[model samples]
Target: MGSVELPGPPRAARPPRPARAPRPRRTIRRRALPYLLIAPTVLALAAVLGYPLVDLVVLSFQDMTRRELFSGATPPWAGLAHYRSILSDGFFWTVVGRTALFTVACVAATMVLSLLVALLMRRVSPWVRTVMTGVLVAVWAMPVMVAASIFRWLSDADYGVVNWLLGLLPGLDFSKHNWFENPWQGFAVITGVVVWGAVPFAALTLQAALSQVPAELEEAALVDGARPGQLFRHVTWPVIKPSAVLVTSLCAIWDFGVFNQIWLMRGGQPEKDYYLLGVYSFIESFAVNRYSAGAAIAVLTVLMLLGGAVVYVRQLVHLGAAE
Candidate 1:
């Protein structure tokens, strides 16, 4: 009772543990780490690419001729004159249409073939998958110029392996057939080269994405009697869709700017029919000596590419955030 009486005095409430100070420094560091990591890349890209882009845009607004270039005279500004001329020209529109069509053909073919190859990789034995992966890596590692050269040889009119093989088909002869004589057939060969180079990367990417699909989900769907197409649409496609969209966007950008295959195939002198935006720009600049016009075309090409670039960046950000 005495001890209880001594405890009767209300003990001062223990001071609330001082609220922990917010570690502003650590919080800042954590927030800043990502930007810091990417800074070098941003700086390097700026150093490498910034000046050219700025110069291109400036040049697009000027009237620069080869005469001025050779004489080392300052180019005169032309405001939107070059853009007006290009936008008004029917031939420019034709080239734009052709470029669009070519890009679609190449991208569509590449996505289909790559998806098939990726699915095949999933179905094969581990050794087969390994072999396929090695082949894809080898193909991906091969330089674009070298691949273009090989395709040139393979499609050579006189001694092409392709022509020889096609000649073997009964009631058909492709021997000494000029693939580039018809623009349609020529573009088909070009599409083949584009798809060949593109498929390996896309297939590899899709294969990696496919690996992340939940097996349990697929099995459950199968057990529920889902058809193959239904299974893919419901279970497999969702997992791979992001990768596919990214790949398709990239393919669109690349194929939209295709130049090397057409140029090399046509022996560095692509015809008017073969003029994608890049080829058109080159022809306008060097071939026709319209520097300002070329720059304008380049600007337009960049604008067209922006849509795909935007899609790619958004998908990449989504992927990063999801992880």
Candidate 2:
């Protein structure tokens, strides 16, 4: 009887709304599409840069030579022999010393030249500044080899234009000076060439940074009876400090890997006097065809660069913290 009460409209069990399948999860690759566009460039870098560097690291532990340049033939295992030789050899030490000296001289010269140029550019009329900028760009645009060749021709002891110019000076050494005869001479030549090539970029960078410095701040300092030296030391120098650091780090890095200058000029001659770390490794690899030794030297060079980068990064961190 109760059932017959006929579920007068058995409360319609509401059909559950069709449960929508959870939206398909977005894939990480889809999210990364923007960055994936850079894959071609990264792949190219992997081919030209990444593979060679990896090969170098692997080859260091193996006794690879010109005979096995690209062949799959296995190289003999010479665990650390090349590395030990590199570390103990007096020649490598000499290269290290020369490399340090070259970096210091070139960096210092480049900084000084760049800072002076920046100051001069700031003081000059806009047109003159523009002209100087054009000239610097021109010099920087010239290929290193072309510049080196020109300098080489001009560096010839007898017919060298530099020697001739020195003769015109009131007090100077006009005698035949072989630019590549010794380490210091070789370094000086390299330093000069590097500075000439590098100063423009530094100058431009500093000039741009200087332009951003508040003129009112400088004027305020001047009004406070600040001498030019004091103004520079207190106001200009602090404002430009970051730019200076950047320039120094960049020049240091550039000079560290400087191969063409040393290769064209010194070729690691005179008991490996002028041999820099970059040139030394290059000669080890290509010139002498000692892949293992070259790889070891290459590893050392990379370590040096990485060490320098670490120090530079630490400096940047400190600079940032200071700010």
Point to the candidate with the largest TM-score: 1
Clashing pairs in 2: none
What lDDT would each prediction earn against the true structure? 0.93, 0.83
> Candidate 1, which ten residues in sequence have the lowest lDDT sum?
1-10
Residue 32, model 1, lDDT: 96
The global Cα lDDT (0 to 1) of model 2 is 0.83
Q: Give candidates' CA RMSD values in order.
A: 6.1, 9.5
| Tens-digit lDDT track of model 1 for 102-139 | 99999999999999999999999999999999999999
Candidate 2 lDDT tens digits, 137-169: 999899988887777778788799988888888
> Each model's TM-score?
0.90, 0.82
